[model samples]
Target chain A: MSELLLQKKHSSYYYVKSKLSTGLPLFAAIFLVLLIALLLLHFIWHGAPGITWAFLTEAPRNNNTEGGIFPAIYGTVFLVFIMSLLGVPIGTATAIYLSEYARQQSFFSRSVRFGVNTLAGVPSIVFGLFGVGFFVQFIGKGIDTAAQTTIWSKPSLIWAAATLSVLTLPVVIVAVEEALRNVPQDLREASLALGATKWQTIWRVVLPNSLTGILTGTILAIGRGAGEVAPVIFVGAVYSLPQLPDSLADQFMHMGYHIYVLATQSPNAADALPLQYASTLVLLILAFSLNLTAAYIRLRIRRSHK
Target chain B: MSSNSTLYKKSKFRPFEAIIEWIIRLTASFSIIIIFLIFIFIFKEAGGLIFGTAKELKPKKAVSEKVQDKSEEKVKPEIYNPETGEIVKIVEVKKLVKAKETESQSIWANLFSDTWQPVGKKPKYGIQPLLIGTFKVTLVSLLFATPLSILAAIYCAFFAKAWIRDIIKPTVEVLAGFPSVVLGFFCLVTVVQGVYSTTQFLQPLCTNIADIISWILPFSDRWIHSALTISDFHYSAVVGGIGLGLAVIPIIFTISEDALSAVPNSYREASLALGATESETAFKVMLPAALPGVVAAILLGIGRAFGETMIALMATGNAALFSWNIFHPVRTLAATIGSETGEVQWGSLHYNILFFLGILLFLVSFIINALTELFVKKYLSKKFQGA
Candidate 1:
């Protein structure tokens, strides 16, 4: 009993020493937290009622004080919607083909997986170069008149959306593949026993089981695609415009771009404060809503599956 | 008759299914097409700049013969001033040709060029100053970030109390959520300004120089003694690099900690059983075991440093001049692209020249990342039993 108590006391001593050693990470974390708090304080103090409903609805003009980010809101939403619409279908289909229809060790599938991972790590700026080269210069050439404008005519929203789809393609493939890999094999066997073909079994049993995961992954990809400034700047000439684009070809606005401009390129240089914060708040809200909706959809699918 | 019955009896349409499969296959193949096409696009735009204006004026020692010969005759030396023994006396002829080669070599030579004064109407797009500035800043950042990040991660994974670990991990991750632009703004308004104000107290710390040594000190007492301030050229790369380092440390620590945590439990237990101290196990056994992931994290940090634009763009003194001093501000390739891209007419010499810079950045970063993923992953980790 005495020996055990002595050992316990010894452990207590080491625990305190361990805590002392932990000081570095703890201090670094706390320092970061303190800086973050200071930044938020600065933001809130300078921007309260300025983050108004009016600010959200108004079009920016006269140094941005007289207008809001109506166009940007629409553009950001449309960008996310269109990118997700295109990216989800192709990525999910590819993931399905890779996971279900092919052997994992096959040369084709292995090479495909390798390409996808490498693509994911390629930098955003590099993607911008690619988009400008392929989408803007080459692909955009065929779609529009060469002398459409004095300069090269800007590629429309359709081109931007398509290019962004390519940029996020690897991410979607990785996500959906992970989701498919998690689905149980027993469900596939059960569906196959019911006289369904491999395609039908995969669609009905395996896909539905993983649909929630697929939705979540798609939402994450869209959220990421929307905020990206590099590729969009290269492929999409979205910035300040008085009117909202009626068609995909017309120049539009994006909340992320709006924040970037207000902080960097605001035409109305003096009043960038309220505009930057308000746009940031809107972006976060949009991202959160998209994620939450996907979560909600996932839950609904789970409940129905059960 | 049998095939017709197959089509009519079932709505499944096997041929249609085959067509859809073909479509999907095309889409899969399309990914490759996109990558290949992108490379083609970058090289096409960048080609005119790198090849040079004329064959005779092309780089004396060609990296390749064909590339040298194909250069436009515009840059070839047609006139000379043997009077002063200058190879090319007429600046205008060379100006036009050098403008095209300025796409790549101009800035590279600028890295070694002694003076930063823009010649006459157009400044030759020399990059030596910016390259010097970038390296100095990056070196400082590594100095600030590497030791702190590695040590903090080691401390957290090996020594932290469980309760503290949970709190520390999440908080550090939340730093990733902060937009990089915001970090730049913060550094500009606060860190840069703070350093400027403190310049008064630091002025006395300058090293004393005798008459001959004065020439070697790079800057005189007047510049060092002046109040720290911000303008286009006069600024601080030290602050910018440190600020960037702070922004990147979380990335390093997060990955490094994961590497540390993933170290096999048996190694720690064995070390402990052998009467090794906690610090010894962490530094010798666990760290060695975790070296692969640590290497990955370090390489990731380096790649990030090379590519980061917004903070460096806004904070680096924006002087496209080369200086060895750590305190003086400098420009990075990323900053140059950001500042010049908007102004340069798209598809013109200046514009193509900027793209050439992008090509350099892409090539350098791509090589680093590829090496890390390909070579370091196998060799470094295996040496430590971490791969």
Candidate 2:
């Protein structure tokens, strides 16, 4: 009878232990779910109703208390366009150099890698300062002195785009390098054996295959550049710029900066609440869609390779 | 199989390969050049403030005869005129700084103090308050966020079913991609309201605790009152901390989850086979193995919190004061630079000061990142070696 009681006690203890372990992890999973649910619910409940056609196509009226954010949208699109134009090619080239040309353990390659890593870790505010000091002051002043004009001696879209490109370069390089390295070594060897030169093989075989991945990187960069406000605030973003930028030298409005200005600097935060939420929604959708597309492309590539 | 054949093949594409390779090398070197330029330009502006230009040397002749000859003083007076002027007056004017500094507090001296008055007759560029403010907010954020992120990471890495894991991972990562400006706005509007009321809701409990403590100590009531205010809570360090905590959770979660998942499955199997519970295996076996990665993740999260700009700027009320109170508003280094750099004069002392703040941020983040990278590299190599 004592032995039977001991067996029953041990079974109960094991049952309780198993139940406790499962319950703990379940609680953690629930907590994560609740957080994500709260974020989505908050944004959609507050923001989705404000996203109307009038909100999208029209410019702000009455000190941004009314109308849509057309100029802010246009400015963000233009900035991303210019940023990609500058960031993608150079980023792709650098990745190719790292993966294909430079020896893995070479000093130059290590330094380049270190530079990319350091640049990646530098704060966005520092990038803003660098933009103002280097692009707006030194290089812009040099250009002004050379041309005997004041055209490029201040914050402008070009300077902001350039700063953002530098900020996102590491992202692009990592993505592109992964893509380049994913191309099978046997394919490159086969191309070389078929009398194709190294550059010819790279240009014809490797780059063509990795173009989708490179595009994915550019898309990711655009998504990041679109959302970043700190790097462009002092460099080029304007609070009440009513029109689309006519040239790269013109200061532009941005969705992120506009939200910040409206939320913090507005006279009537209550009245501007709808606009702020709507602008945030637009920015969220933009960044989300871009990220999703890149993720999808990466997934497709991975699947195809398998 | 002949060396000559290989040599001939190499020679065929030597010129093309050389030019293409040079272009690639140039593109790669451009990143290094840009990084160096960032260092150079920031320091150049910051250095200008530390060392100003030379003093003006005016040749002022000391009238030996005490004659009031202002006009003759302008000209070099002759040695034998009625009185000889032999002395020089060197008027050493102070360098043009951004703010008018009083004679008592030097810039270096002011930085060690708690006051951060940057625009006035006696402008004080005290970094102590900002540092304290940063530390307070970061501490609050990490305290609130680290456990949540770590537990969630463990759940995702070990316990979540496959479909649930797929949904949870991307959804959380979506939070990571959300713009900080939006997060700042949300904090300004929603989170601040939530935090204020939550603090207010805890008033009775706080008073109870304070009452309990007051029985032991005479000054507990005053300390509690100062620590927990009944009302008047608006934009504050607590609000900023919550906002920053939200911003950092995704980073910490993603990194820590990766670290947890990178632990070898054999460890889990062995622990399970030895009759250990799953939680025991996870908490005892896996967590210890992934401790380096976890440390690296937390350090990266702290680095991110230190450099975060928009949330702190919008939510922290931009008040620079000397208080250890978490309920009061405080400014940060990143926010100060973000808000002030736009209006500051290009070559003024204030502009250079902002650049100096940038340098401080750069250096701090650099050190944190270097340490994090060191630990992360070790973790990755250890994982790869199957040990």
Candidate 3:
């Protein structure tokens, strides 16, 4: 080393002190270790089963030897569909109201944000309670009496869907708001300068720009709706109903709750094992894919906008 | 032209803008309507158990009273088999027994019993055991998880290097992706097995170790080694604590990390420039600054751990002991409510009890969340002011 450089480095206490500021590696080490451990456990415990069309379509059997999670998979898909239909537009509109139109810093708007945040933090069980009390009972009335087509035939699915939608709506609104906020204010001003009405500016410019983010958030909310077991169990989920719901009113089974029950309550070791893992895999895949799709859209939009 | 426009605008705000403002204001106000509706529905569903049920439950209560009265009855019934006939008539003996039996069902009356025998001839739905179990598991979990998460956050926020921070931030969040069922499975298949065995092996070893330590310290051998028994550590509060802890670790880590990072860098720099070490700056300076948010994280973490269903359902043995012993089995409200949903008929007392459990859960987490929000709001308000 050069004598001048060597002297300066040795003379300064800053060099020694700078080395002490390393917490990042520690954090990374812990995180990676935990993730790897969890993944390894998941893969190791959940053995790959031979997936067949028969396995995916058949019902659980009288004996604990052969059955697929067809009913559960069917139920989860229906749930995600309902949650998306109910949550998407309402959440998008709410986000638009918060970000584009409203001065959310105002007291009224601030309180609204507070409510949304509180709702977000409320436990899943509380949502279950609400689902049971509201959807299954109060709202179940008109739909419950169909009596012909579904196990529940009349009421449960719509109510559960509505409840799940509201439960996840806050997250959608927040994500959508963030996405909308990411739209540069200059774009809005430019539109206004061209004599566009506020609604026209928002619809033509702000919303189109934010669509990617809004979709991502909406999908994320759906993923949450999919994995949930607690509230839906109370509001819906009949015990191991053998058949799939032919219609909305048809009573349903669920993957998450099924896994919970099979693993905890049922003693069908070999039979339920593969089915549980497969069902879990299906639910995880659904959640992951939805999240990934939304994330991909957001990334694409962001790149173009940038 | 600008002055004319300004004068026109100053004379009165535009009616269209005013209307738009009102619309915006109304949308914000709508959340209140949402909360109210939620409360109304939850209370109504839960309300059936409280005010609406008199037939099934009330008759059971009367039956129980008759049973109790019979147990204390002084007189006996005379036998009546005067003729060999198809009709079988027996005279009642103890009025008290009949009164108690008429008053309530044993199963229904003992809903608060520490033991849960849901499938017995005299089915019991004693949720007290489950509630106690829930409490033990939750308390243990929060105890285990809260500290580690907060510490991890603090270290990451103030002390970690660049590459480590980047990796840790997202990596820690992976916990969020691990579904609850997966976690429950892990606890049941792996963790429970590990704990059960470890408790067995460690009992003698732990007792010896404790005994040895106690000899050096103040306690006696019997107390220390007995503590080491397999029963002491197997399926104990510690296992549930660890599982629950893992479940909520990311939640606490994320929130606390944000709060810690939100503390101004200037303060850390200033404290460090005064010759205090980086550790001192983190411990004495940033932590105190981020205390409120950290507290919020802990409270929310507590709430999460408390309400967590799947983990407790799979891991805890669901024993309903009122005893505060950590080694014994515990039942929680969520788990019992969850497991019973399939078995219990809708509108039954057990079903109502589940709703009641939901009410308890709602009331608790609501308070925790309210406090968390209040703390976070105040913390941020103070934080921004300081900044």
Candidate 4:
């Protein structure tokens, strides 16, 4: 009887140990989910009240402690728009070359892949430095020297957009390539079997199918580009601008930079707290909506393909 | 049928197609060119300092002497006759000799010293404190993020049902979507206050633990005492690290979850068939198989945290303090560049130093990526070869 009791105790102890181990990881996952929820709630709770139509439409007044963030919003939109125009086509073409044309493991393809990976890993601040050194000092100054004008030699919207396009290139390439790879080999084979040329098959069959994916890539790149402030800090972003940018040559305000300046450098930061929260809220909503749309498109593609 | 035959005949020598393909290939190679351009341009800016060719160095002695004379004149107690516009009395100051000692030191000595004051009359461009700050913040962030992410990854990979997985995955992606600046703002506005209070509450408990550890292990007393003491909690490395950890968690989680799920089902079955518990199979068989990927994920996460700028700039107090206390305010390399590079003269020594820090950040991330690539390749080969 005692031996049986001891055996029962041992089994109970093992059962409790197993339960504890599983419980620990589950608790961790729950913790992370709750943390995210709490963060979002905190932002919305404080920031939602400050968000109004006027707040989104008018320019800041009184040393950026009052009024709205209209100029920053405009600049951010313009920045990302230019970035996508420059980045998407090149990224899509590169993705096509990698997925549809280049032989796997070829030296050139491998080198290109390595370059993409390295570019993805590079820090944003270094990108800013590169922008200043290459775009502002080198190319911009080169243009100025040729034109005999000082317009291009300083930080401006064009240089910032160019730098951001470079930064977002890897994101677009990865997304578009994944989308291209999802197009089945049988479809490509069938197109080629019909006596269609390689370019015709790709342009007709592959590109059509991956159009949503390419759109997704562009949206993702835009989302990333809109939110990034470091690369714009030296290239074009200013703390405050009295007027909206008229051209790519003009320096402009950015949402992220505006928030940063308000949080760190405002003369009366406490008084500006509501404006800071409201600005962060707007930026967050923009980024989240863009990311969600891209994710939704990606999910639909995956489901349809399956 | 006649039109189709004509089209086929026309497609036989499609010059446009060949040209388009070549253009596509060239555009694909632009990534490679851009990478080289980034390296060359950044290095070009830093080359002045690295090669000692900056024009600032040529007039260093004259500049230092001018600074010295100005500093001495300010320190001296002098009486001025306003009508005559001349000094009637002057007292010699001893600070002149000490200033001379610092000014005469070699550039390398100043570069490696503990201070990071780059804007003063006699600028000291020491980089040690920034390096230490970056190291401390990265270490704290890794400590906070790695285990939590890994555990969550394990649960999502091996334990969670399909429905739960769907919810958790999207939530993590939302977290990932948060802009770093937003995270920095959150930390500045809310998290620092929360952390400060929490640390203040935990101080006594930590002191008690330190005392017990010192009593239990005499050899570890000094370091443990220093490590556990939370003197001040405002805008510290610990707070900055937590902010950064929030940024890093999603990257580590997604990669690690993919790796863990990629572990074949056969290993799970084999372990289970041997009477191992479900958790046991996950811990022993699946995790070991996915070790390479998990390690690669962690390295990538480290790379992300190491060079993250806005969070470090906003949350870490930007003090450039040389201390091991996790609760002490610290400044990082990227933060220094972000804050100082704006107003600095384009071709100044301070600008070159910031670029030098950029070079350091670039090299570190490059090495991390190369290492991660090596691990991923090794894992892929092993899996395909049925090792």
- Candidate closest to the true structure, highest DockQ: 2
Q: Enumerate clash totals for all models, in the order shown.
A: 9, 0, 47, 0
Chain A TM-score for each candidate, in the given order? 0.81, 0.92, 0.82, 0.94
How well does each candidate reproduce the native contacts, as fnat? 0.15, 0.63, 0.32, 0.70
Interface RMSD of each: 7.8, 4.8, 5.8, 5.8
lDDT of 2 by residue, B15-82 (tens): 76788789889999988998889888888878655553101101111222122344336534433345
Residue-wise lDDT of candidate 1 within B72-114, one digit each (tens)? 3434564456577665634554464555555345544643465
Model 3: DockQ vs. true structure: 0.29
Which stretches of model 4 miss by more than 4 angstroms?
A: A1-16, B1-15, B61-105, B207-228, B384-387
TM-score of each: 0.76, 0.89, 0.81, 0.90
After superposition on all CA atoms, what RMSD does each candidate show versus the true structure? 8.5, 6.2, 7.1, 6.3
- Per-residue CA lDDT of model 3 for A1-306, tens digit only, reads 579756755765656544543444355447545754676457445744635677678776754346776787788788778888887777777777777655535676667777787677666767776776666655565355654323442336766787788888887888888788788767877887787766667779888888788778878898888877776876676557766777676668888877777776676666677766766666667767776687677777677767
- The stretch of ten residues in a row with the least summed lDDT in candidate 4 chain B is B1-10
**Candidate 3 wrongly placed segments (more than 4 Å):** A1-32, A49-64, A105-107, A142-155, A238-243, A296-306, B1-31, B57-128, B209-236
In model 1, chain B matches the true chain B with a TM-score of 0.72
> Who wins the TM-score comparison?
4
1 against 4, candidate with superior DockQ: 4
